[model samples]
Target: MAGQIPIIPFGPHATCTLELCPIEYSIFRYRPSLAANITFVVLNVIFALTHLVLGLRLKNWWFSGAMVAGCVSNIIGYAARVFLWQNPFSFIGFLLQIIFVGSAPVYYTAAIYVTMTRTVENLDVSLSRIKPKLYYVIFIVCDTGALVLQAIGGAVSTVSSGANAAGVNLALSGLIFQVATMLAFVGLLIDYLIRYFRDRPVASVATRLKLFLASLSLAILLILARCAYRVAELSEGYNGVLFHDELLFIGLEGVLIALAVVALGIGHPGLVFKDGQANLTKAYSPVSVPGGAESGVELVGK
Candidate 1:
């Protein structure tokens, strides 16, 4: 293994003596471009900081925590890529990107699950096909399963000497499961939307609800695209063409997730449910009576 690929620096490299180190290799061969990696790291850090400030300001404990976790995971994953740029054969760096970046989106998905439950509760849970509580219960549980599979797969592959079919399959199964969950969740969301609109006119809907739903939808699409790309990449094993294509990785995984994070921030539930208005289970609002007299109704009351 030590003599497999020539060691770097064109000399007796100190770090390449381990079982995982290549005899000779360039970081470029593994990581490709360094510029994009650095950009993602910086962007993630900025996004994390922004989420922290907003989360604190709005006191959205759950949403803020989930977003911050996802952002930090992105930052750490890209930082690992930076280390890989320095030493492409670094097993630790590879592991970091695989587990952190691969599993980070699960946190964001959890946040979305929570937000959907809250949305249904706020708008009209009776209008939804599934119960509001079931939203988080089902999706979060599925997300946890996906996260565990990916993490275990990363660990197994890290320890496995060469291309491990079992490890790759585990990781692929996790990605596939994630995509399936996303599809199901989206179907439910669309169903709820259809039911809600069918019962109530779009004009009667609150503007805040519209913005929040749109943002959540955008994030869902971005994450789905990123996860699908990962599934395809991992299905081919480590040495596959998609695995080596840095641009595709940056565009599909990094760029898509970055946009999703930003979209969530814009559609942060705090924007709508603020000042202890987070739980709208029985929220109500003022409505007009038959005699043009204003009356209070349970329609998103503040």
Candidate 2:
């Protein structure tokens, strides 16, 4: 009974053929087709190549690495999903992806956190008020906690099946926590950006900064939306609602994650031509020098 896909809860509430209720929970091991496996691999390949190029172009290994990690994890996770598509009971595949893909963004978020603060350091450090390092330190701490909870939750979810209420709860908690964390991070970033822009309103974004910020924001938004959807879908226990709905999972999870990877590519700071000499000379200073001193740097509040 568990191996087969079960009737959906919201449907007739009567006997339902698997066809009648596509959203029914299925205990059978989830499996993927050949096309799916290929898709995942392709995604990862593109991710690797894009990040490598970006790293070279921007000379920002940390940013490149974080983006690459997210993309690579996504690729691996999708591959695992494809495996599950082949064998629904492939717990190993599910676990590998659930752990890696779900938590990979922590690295990206940390990169964003670090990048923002570093931007301030490079710019008018005094205008930033808080030390750039502080954001990295604080957010990294929170991101680590989120990663732990999500990993634990994913593990619990895989084992629980329809009966693992506790695990489901844990997974839900982690998803919710992650969603909250991302939102907070986004808010913090927006705040900083607002301040930075206010102080340096006239300074156009350097090409690298534009790509870096764009890609980072898109990835964050995509992940945040995906997490929110997952939380909603999984809020009901496997047997109760659209617990094991595959289509929704593909749409919300697979597509969203894929988009994140692609967005990262487009937003890769690599598009800008890197001048090695300038980087060596400027080291870590802000790219532009806007209105040098004399006038007070004003704080622009939202």
Candidate 3:
């Protein structure tokens, strides 16, 4: 390709003309085998199809939407890499996947927020201190903040070849915001889980609830790992040591996130929400009150 780096794909790459660009240079860093890349592509595509069907079949819009967002980003990003494998100089393909896939985690995070809050509402909102609406407002705002920051970072780096300090700063800031949001979410989740499990009604799907909580935790862990990788990668600027490491990005961001998505799917609220077993009114009795009504408000205090 004219005006582009002459980079090789992964292993035993054929020699080319121009020098590799910093961004394209790492297209195969710590790189997986061609076989692994193929696996990643296939797995993500299958996940996307499954979510598309489930979202439509059950009308679980939020979970379905988030899964779709994640799968789409992963697929598009990998597709771009596939094109670059043909010719690593294709900057356009590089950007399309990098930006979309990098930010896709945010949507999954949002989906988790929706599901968890919905669980609270559908199960026992009165036991919780924070209302479901406020939880939505707060977490979604954080998600939007992360999205905008990452998007700006992508735009800025594109114009400046990923070395723009401003762009790196913005991206890092967004990631930091996401990390903080997740930490808070985890705290609330732990608190809620403790209270819920301790006082759970006989009707609650205990096993399913455990799975949902586990999946949500896995998602948070994946996002946290990705953010840490970004922070390390960007701290050194575009050409810095970790900046162009494709292998690291794939392992830390790609595989970690893909695992989280699958985990979340297994623990989806649909597992718990199905069959109306969670209906609260008929399951609880005022007479079973812990404090003989002297505690004033009915609380599932742990």
Candidate 4:
């Protein structure tokens, strides 16, 4: 059995002399953390349910759908961890967690990008360097690209028995791309906020708008931190020392994402937009006139 190559369905009797599967050998070497996995599963379930209820009540279909997708991925990812806890050799479980959890945040960030567009529309679109629609177009497209790279890389790694160096590189590239997109978004967000406040008196800004901006900013920061940590983790190959640090994974990946989801709930778009209440027809209007007529042009030059 010592000389035989390790094969799937690994067990005590298998001829595969390999000490552990590369997918999550660090986790398998020691029993997977049951408590940590279960906690994440529960947290994701709550986040999913809350978002669904709020989304339906507020009629925010797009936001709700993205959050639901992320939650489902989290559920599957942690459930995979639970399976690994039972049997570290479960290849299917390892693949499930790796792909789903790794890409789940992409959906969340996309939702956030959409919200940014809405924010710009709601608050002085003239203040932003980029138009509201372009924010959605640019960031969502970038998010899609990141999601594809990650999904492809994860699939390739799974097919290669989790030993492919190319797969890791592809995934790392996706993470790095995501980080760059987020940084650019932050720059735009800061610029818009600064210009809006400087041009318009602070007293004109609504308290609710302030809250929404604060909440969105917090979520973005949390996500950026999580993605940065992931980039570092993957920088080291699968066998890198980072894999052995369960606490780091739990804190950076699990806890940070969980907080971001919850922050979104607190700062939900529904709170500000008020379900068909905002006059989107006047979103880019320069001024309001009698009979609810808006100035036809956005003459305020950027």
Give the top-scoring candidate (TM-score): 1
Winner on lDDT between 1 and 3 is: 1
> Candidate 1, overall lDDT?
0.77
Tens digit of lDDT per residue, candidate 4, span 1-302?
Answer: 88865565332233222354453343234556899999999999999999999899988888888998999999999999998787776667777888888888888888888888877776667778988888879998998898788778767765665478898889888889999999999899888878766644555445555677888989989999999998898888666778667788889999999999988888888766756233333123243434765443221111
Candidate 3 — which pairs collide? Answer: 29-247
Across residues 45-141, which tens digit of lDDT does each residue of candidate 3 receive? 8988988787776567778888888888888777776766655645565577668777778778888888877778765687676987667789989
Clash statistics: count for each candidate: 7, 15, 1, 1
Error (Å) of candidate 3 at residue 102 is 0.9
lDDT of 4: 0.77
Candidate 3 global CA lDDT score: 0.68
> How far out, in Å, is residue 34 in model 1?
2.2
- What ranges in model 3 sit over 4 Å off? 1-33, 200-205, 275-302
CA lDDT of each candidate? 0.77, 0.63, 0.68, 0.77
lDDT of 2 at 87: 46
lDDT of 2 by residue, 1-302 (tens): 76876543221132333345332233432334567557767867787777778687667787788777777777777777766564444457657767876776676676667666655654446655467688788777877876787677666656665466777787788778778877877887677667766655444444455555677788779878988887887687655445456566667777787787677666543333233111122112233345574332211111
Listed in order, each prediction's TM-score against the native is: 0.84, 0.73, 0.78, 0.83
Q: What is the lDDT, from 0 to 100, of the residue 48 in candidate 4? A: 95
Screening candidate 1 with a backbone cut-off below 3 angstroms (N, C-alpha, C), the clashing residue pairs are: 5-23, 5-24, 6-23, 6-24, 7-23, 7-24, 284-301
